[model samples]
Target: MAALHELPSQMRAVYLREYNKPYELVTVDVPNIRENELLVEVHAAGFCHSDLQVIHGQFGTKLPIIPSHEPAGVIVQIGSKCSGPWKVGDRVGVLNFKNACAKCVGCSLSQKRYRNLDPRFCDNRETAGFQHDGAFAQYLAADPATTVLLPSSLSFEQAAPLMCAGATVWGALEKATSGLEPGATVAIVGIGGLGHLGVQFAKALGFTTIALDSRQAGRDLATEVPGGLGPDLVLDSTASDAAEKVLAFTKGEGVAAAVVCTDSIVANTWTLRLLRVGGVMVPLGLPPDRWQFDADVLVFRELVIRGSYVSSAESTRRMMEAVGRSGVRSHITTVELDDVPGIVDMYQEKNFRGRLVVKMRD
Candidate 1:
């Protein structure tokens, strides 16, 4: 963890030395599992925007760590301490935030607020692929605390993205659900990778959903929602009268919730305009700089802003159920494990929707 132990001049290699460099194919031993860990034969791993930030040193994560946090696979081995129903050869999906230390504020049951939410906020947690090694390898040491049994109906390729991207948006939607009545209107802004899934989640929850995005492809993806689950409508967020259209569609009351999946401050600003009085807004994207909002929108309309929250275990199971029922799926572009470098470049250069995943095996 300390800069690869300050390699000597003769041993210093060009890559795998630090962040902002290409990852090399390093032959390391298969990860070993601890008492609470499960040795997962990773069938698939997902690429997230945060993975990009980690590589760029934005999160200040421990350097020289295996990246890609989303892993869906079969359990090849389980530690003796893992006494749940989990067993060898069982299909599974792991949440990135694992190895929860129960005493921390984030993990303590008394901290009801954080208890059901992400464990990544726990001060002492060891996040796979972030604070330490991750799922990019053939086998990852996964914690049972954050691992969920993948539904038999779901394939590993699709299940991998659900581990993060799917759970994240679902978490936001769950927050939005608490603040609304049954079948309220909700708006999903920015229909890219996260937004596309957001649209399905909103629809599956029976909300009168609206999909918004400037990109034609994003708008199109909304209509092409898997299993025909719909947002009910798709509107270009960039239109001059976009807010007006949404307000009129909602009978001037505006949507009950607006989930902003894009990182653009300008686009996020537009979402505030679509919210009715007391409407909640959940922004999932983490932009580099702080978000700027008009104080008047918050004060006058009494609009509420919230972050995504739900028990890592609970959210994964609920998301799996939704996937099973409504057939929600990721529009993933998968690359073999060895071709991750190419996927990294594609994520940066290509304007694509949904997730980029690594297929660890055939």
Candidate 2:
């Protein structure tokens, strides 16, 4: 066991005591560092829509859990068994997925190289914030393997979103367009946190980027990208001819691929029509209800539909490097810890712009 700190024994944390309830700030025992874990003094944590899902009892997670999964912090202490490439004071971002049974086939395969026969094979996997304590608190015990060391150039607030949202989009894009040639027409549907990052990434990768969203604000933000690359076209999905508009923008041949970043079934349905023959649509959002698509359209066009889950730690690191080097970054608004509950309510009402980060310390 490590020696106890002579300083404060209790720390402030945002915790939920029950389902469908707001997170409350309370003093709890500082978490103990495990042999493979590092004690991270959390600086900032990003609030994701999935966090709202967990809070609302939609994801089947247990009650009385810490909410934030996108956490970035400084390592205050390291465990006895910890070694190599990390030390005290390292700035890092923590991922939500933790230890898996190494004996399992999925675990044995590296994330970049593995191909599982079944998508549901890893269904029983454990995750932080869902199976273990998460970052909505002042301190988090993060597995060193799951932590991505952030460059000193990135601030904690900026790095927090990369832990989850940034990595997710990056990973999805990598998978969806692995063999994509330069100048391929790519459409990003939604233009929220993940979609916004997806647009920037697609543009950076030399694709002809198009932004699709229903809101004027989203289109406005997408158009303001530096150097005016600003989406080759911005289509307002709310318009009656959204699919036609997209097809027209692609010169009636349709986009080479589309990444569905929203959970809306309507958006998914419309996006399918905007893909050329053999084009792919990668679905990243988790919608509540089931959706259906025309079988003939899929069969005749030979269009591919796939779903992408959260990204791996290695990809997460690459995402951070990409963010550090490019002008593309998440637009975040900082909020204090005490204001999280209210923010959650506002998020439910869909009232905020960009991503929200909880500042754990002054």
lDDT of 2 by residue, 190-210 (tens): 888788888888887788988
Q: Which window of 10 residues has the lowest lDDT sum in candidate 1?
A: 6-15
Model 1 stretches with alpha carbons more than 4 Å out: 1-16, 109-111, 114-118, 309-311
The per-candidate count of clashes, in order, stands at 2, 0
lDDT of 1 by residue, 120-168 (tens): 6677888776777788877787877788998888999999988888888
The local lDDT score (0 to 100) that residue 315 gets in candidate 1 is 71
lDDT of 2: 0.79
